[model samples]
Target: MEALYATTTGLLAACGVYLTLRGRTFPVVVGLTLLSYSVNLFLFSMGGLAMHGNPAVVGAGTPAADPLPQALVLTAIVIGFAMTAFVVILAMRARGDLGSDHVNGNRLDVSREDGK
Candidate 1:
């Protein structure tokens, strides 16, 4: 299970990075989301798969998954949402300012860049 998770995490991350380097705003945002999901899964897996477990507050007689990773995943989730929102808003603003959704190589944005 751990190996499976690792493989999945790697594949998704690689794909996300590849897609993220594209010129379109949509694919890049989607790739970012995919990468974030992989990161979350990777972190979650670090806690180890639990079987017959209890909360850490109970100390003995029970195996418990690490709470630290869980907490981190929770925090990352919220932060990731905020990041996605910010990226999306930036995409929109770039679209409005340059009248195209492409990233660095967009015609209008490129023309503007040439002026600088």
Candidate 2:
């Protein structure tokens, strides 16, 4: 389970980084989201991967799961959502004003064509 979790997190972070390096606004936004997800997963895992554990509020003899990571992840998710929404809106506005969806307000193909 630990190996699987680590692999999944690593994959997400790798993909997120790849997409983020793209020269398009949409892909960058998606990449940022994926990166956030990876971070959330990392943060959550820091609290331990206890399965069938009791809640932190419980006074059972068994060890209880830590609630701190859970709370942090939840908060991060909310913030990530808001940030994603804002970035989307900003991208839309940039698209409208610049007449292009590229990160630099210019099409890569067009620039390449011009160089030819």
Report the C-alpha lDDT of model 2 over 29-101, residue by residue, as the tens digit. 9999999999999999998898888887755667898899999999999999999999999999999998888
Clashes of 2: 0
User: Candidate 1 versus the native: TM-score?
Assistant: 0.82
Global lDDT of model 1? 0.86
TM-score of each: 0.82, 0.90
lDDT of each: 0.86, 0.92
Error of 2 at 77 (Å): 0.5
Q: Compared with the true structure, what per-residue lDDT tens digits does model 1 show for residues 30-115?
A: 99999999999888888787767687775475667788999999999999999999999999898899787888646866566559
Q: Any runs in candidate 2 off by more than 4 Å, and if so which?
A: 107-116
Q: Give the CA lDDT, 0 to 100, for residue 1 in model 2.
A: 92
In terms of TM-score, the best-performing candidate is: 2
